[model samples]
Target chain A: MTTMAERTRTTSGAPGGTRTLTLGKAVNEGLRAAMRRDDKVMLMGEDIGPLGGVFRVTDGLQAEFGEQRVVDTPLAESGIVGTAVGLAMRGYRPVCEIQFDGFVFPAFNQITTQLAKMHNRTRGAVELPVVIRIPYGGGIGAVEHHSESPEALFAHTAGLRVVSPSTPQDAYTMIQEAIACPDPVLFFEPKGRYWAKGEVDLDAEIGSSTLDAARVVRAGTDVTLVAYGPSVETALKTADALAQEGRSAEVIDLRAVSPMDTATVVTSVRRTGRCVVVHEAPVFFGAGAEIAARVTEECFYALEAPVLRVGGFHTPYPVAKHEHDYLPSVDRVLDAVDRAFAH
Target chain B: MTTTNGSNEAIPTLQLLDPEGRRVTTRGTKGYRDRAATLTAEDLRGMYRDMVLTRRFDDEATSLQRQGELALYAPSRGQEAAQVGSAYALRPRDFVFPSYREHGVLQVRGIDTVDRLRFFRGSDHGGWNPYEHNAQVYTVVIGAHALHAVGYAMGVQRDGTPLDAHDGTAVITYFGDGATSQGDVNEAMVYATVNQAPVVFFLQNNQWAISEPTTRQTRTPLYRRGEAFGMPSLRVDGNDVLAVYAATQEALERARRGEGPSFIEAFTYRMGAHTTSDDPTRYRTTDQEEVWRRRDPIDRLAALLRAEKELDDDYVAEVQQSADELGVRLRAGVRALDGGAPVSTFDDVYATPHGVVASERAWYEAYEAGDPPADQYAIAETAQGGAR
Candidate 1:
């Protein structure tokens, strides 16, 4: 195992200048940068102020930005978004922090209705432009509602834009970009990847990352692995493992859950002729469902099997011992991949 | 719009036009209806116009929903007088928080008719702005809108807007009788009272919650419930647009004077189903609807208008025709909703995924070779149908 400092950057990555950043540090930088540039950018959520958030992404922000900007709200999700809506209406760009993924249900109505529709209803009269910062996805050995991958719920809404960044760079850049967007955005930061560190160009404009585009993490010719938010890392590892087994794999990180980068997924499927998507949400209905449907229509002739998905089981996220089973692990991903090839 | 106040010197019940359509002069009163002498005949005519137009839009939107255009529609069929009369009384600066209903109020506030249906149609969450129309989004969660309205009124208090609107800019929240049972509504009253927020808690007691009768929502009358919270409460004949207008106008003025919150329960009936999916016959009776139908606010007002020469048979026909044309525009608007869904990627609950979701998002990418979504049809069909 290499030390954090000794970890190598992806040299064979895209021709663009490569930088290695842990998912956590990227988000931290994104927040710091957003706040540094715009005094209107404020962060508020439980444990976000002096404590730097439960996960510590906003760890040093309070001291740096002061309590007025890095606010620590009570343990109330609805209250947080509700107040933030008020603040935003007052022209303050609030970057709300939701401690856990599943904990977002309490604020679901606020996000889905008020936050999502405010712009359209107002006829763009009010651009909430508020960012709901959430640490989503499964694992972390948590309880019910705490381990949900409920991105589909937000994506199901029309007016709200939902995005998840996979890499440390994406984590950092997307946060700023999300805050800078004119519409309400639910920015899901991969909590597990918080410790993963990489380089972030302090001078880069964070909004450069399109809030609605998909990114291809790795290129392969035989099969395409599609995922987003926290699943990008797993998809990469799975791709590497598949390579050892002589199966070529392409990994696509669907950074935006709504207005899905359907073209990217279809392009890959049209070329590779096989597809396997992975998500941490229950398999019954997740982002994979949307991806599979679109691919079948656009690239039906290219598909050898029905779009295969590796996701959480039908039941609730199980206890720790069975969590590995509940989550779509590398093995499960590959198993699905194997099934796709078998077809 | 005439309000709920004694037009005559002695009687207690509010009056604008008697059932016989004659203007009964109030000998003398300080309330707004008494001040009706200050308004020219044109002001009365304009109020009538707003009430009629709002009803037209409301009826058209309902028909669109019935025709399978909107995902869901909450008809202000019988509550038009309660909503519009109050809305028309307010100045532009006054903010309003409305429950899932209030199609009439939105119209009076100058919100586009088709825009209101964007949410119920499932194409967008809301197509109107709170600031522009001075009305908040149509809150679907019962009684929750009251809290937001109260909070906004608190903001209004903080900003000195309530006290500054000398001409009477105040916050008014419209909710149904059934919503009075929600804890949020109670808490909202508490906040509004304690903070002395310049707000009006307008409860349109539309006598039913889906299939449940008003009796199910309250053991005591909703208007009296406000007195418990130290608010001046009144139960007006909601079917009378004139009464609702006068009462709401007085309340809005009082609020603007920093007089704190007031509760006005517009006693009306849910003439139509709670929503299009509702079958009043299932839990209620058509006979009950028929009884309320004769007391129709529109008819009652039209009868008065005829007696006053404010409207003739030809004018009535013209208004109905104009409403039908407006309905056509609203139908076109509903059809124009964007066909495209949003981006497909995890919005990550917030800015980031908490823990393993990161690796999971990464792992998800590893399992696939091409950009193929898993089950797009299920998402479109299920989510799309929910609003409908």
Candidate 2:
């Protein structure tokens, strides 16, 4: 299932200086741009070179940059990330890719214990400017191990900057920003939205926003719906459906998960007075719990009701046949929104 | 190019000097002796002094830990020859990544005893700058830094440095036999060989991985495992300083020659507990300890020096005097340390400032200053740029 065709041409957006591309292709352009700008940028991952990538996100990178820059590594996840750590220490910006979400655990020790702590452990003598890209969250009809959300695990880590992108423009811009960061960044790509097309300008201004800031995707006043990665679209859809029912739900896309832009989130929650969190990961100890805790403490007086959560059950991501039920959908987000209104 | 027996199978071990301190010229070790002979009597005496001082420092640190002056100590008592010999073969520019027990290696790299002891004294994570000494900080997690070394070597190669040249620009990483079982180590071998990275994997098999013996850690010989990854592998008489030095020198030469990675399994024993927290008596027998004691690296080196008429009473007294001075300085330095600022914890979490960490630091400061619970969150909220 490898595609050899190189689609290098950019498509124009509707009446704007932007281009419409899939989230995966936007990421491909972002990587290409980053490599073009910096000679020190290198890519390493399994099936990322000749085969482009499992999702074709790295299509034609190896051919354009040569195998030295875009390497097709062995099927060892820990090896990929660990080597990236060394390369970073040696003054190279290595952008590593973990093929699947569940496969990231093999490299967890290196990521959490070594890469995350190297800067702090060395007392700021060394900066690990490495970006670990993982295709996370479920909604695609993929089997187990292929689709999962382990963002919370990395977010819980102290030294790592965890972020996820919900749209093509974000996927394109954030990937480049994460690469330039001096600290180690865990960039979670929502695999389910890889094929979702949106407008992203190839020549857009760089560094327009720090990769860690949250954005208000859709504005309303009655209540706020918070989500990231795969769940952001569902929350927006819930807002659209809620508007018909006169609920006027505000949706916040939490692009940065770790040094979480709780300021923006708390600002929206204060205005809306009610909040509902949506996520595909299990609710217990997931990003929802963190958002709920932060909103409660920051907007204690402004909150009209207790925050509600709509997310996957506390179990492993199910088989393809039942994945739709396993993932947080528009109805699920709306149900949580309804619960917040009822309270 | 490690020496092999005539049978077309690799020799299980290469010992240039036997335990009795006599240089051996057997078929398996014959080639290395000539390399070892390049070192003069003065050079050998330096190695002896290094091993002796390192051991004395280790002993004093262990006692300091027991006396509650330090948190804990990983003694490099019996493994000094392995650490010192291999480290002596490296140039100042060659990058070195070490596991926690490479105090001897640190000493060889000119790491100040005070800065090194601060880590064990609970005053610092790793006090010395790695870049300052061409050595990375102590990596406690086993086999993790092997990948770092390989990556660094790969970077060296990418920078257009000729691999085969003796330009004093190679990489060497040290880990224990127990780290062999780690996936990162195995993955590091794969990357090193595939990229033909200019690096050497020095495995100090000190017999025990804490409570487990070398046998429990691996079934076959640890050096042979490197062969499976297509790396040139050899086992050395770790306690024999000359043998280890020769093996490491050859390994470094091979790495510099653009010959990918080399693995040196320094066969030795840990004469003390794994750390200050372990009790060796519960896991090892006295007979086993006695067998390794007869092969003490320092004793064997001392015997070799004495037989050659190089270690006279005056030299012994001078070395003793230096070791005594080292102990006095280490004790005074540790006591003089202020244990650093308590708020320094909020520093270095990220190279760039982070909103979350800043808020948490503010909250911690307010709490430490006896702010009530409500005011602490208010301070954190203000610090994080949240609207109150």
- The clash numbers for all candidates, in the given order, read 93, 3
Best DockQ among the predictions, by candidate number: 2
Best by TM-score: 2
My TM-score estimates for the predictions, one after another, are 0.67, 0.94
What's the TM for chain B in candidate 2? 0.93
The number of the candidate with the highest lDDT is: 2
What TM-score does the predicted chain A of each candidate obtain versus native chain A? 0.91, 0.94
Per-residue alpha-carbon lDDT of model 2 for B267-323, expressed as tens digits?
888999999999999988999789889989898888888998999999999999999
Q: Evaluate all candidate structures by whole-model CA lDDT and list the values in order.
A: 0.72, 0.86
Q: What fraction of the correct interface contacts does each predicted structure contain?
A: 0.11, 0.66
Q: Write the per-residue lDDT of candidate 2 for residues A64-153, one digit (tens) a residue.
A: 999889989888988898889888878888999999999999999999999999988888888898899999988778877998899989
Q: Which digits, one per residue and each the tens of the lDDT, describe model 1 over residues A1-343?
A: 1111121111211123545666776677678867776667788788887777778788788998886687666556776677576556656778888888878887887787677766555545666768898887767777766677778888888667778888777776677767776668888877766776767665554433365678788999999999997788899999899889898899999888865767678778889999998988877778888788878877887788889988987887787667777788899898898888787
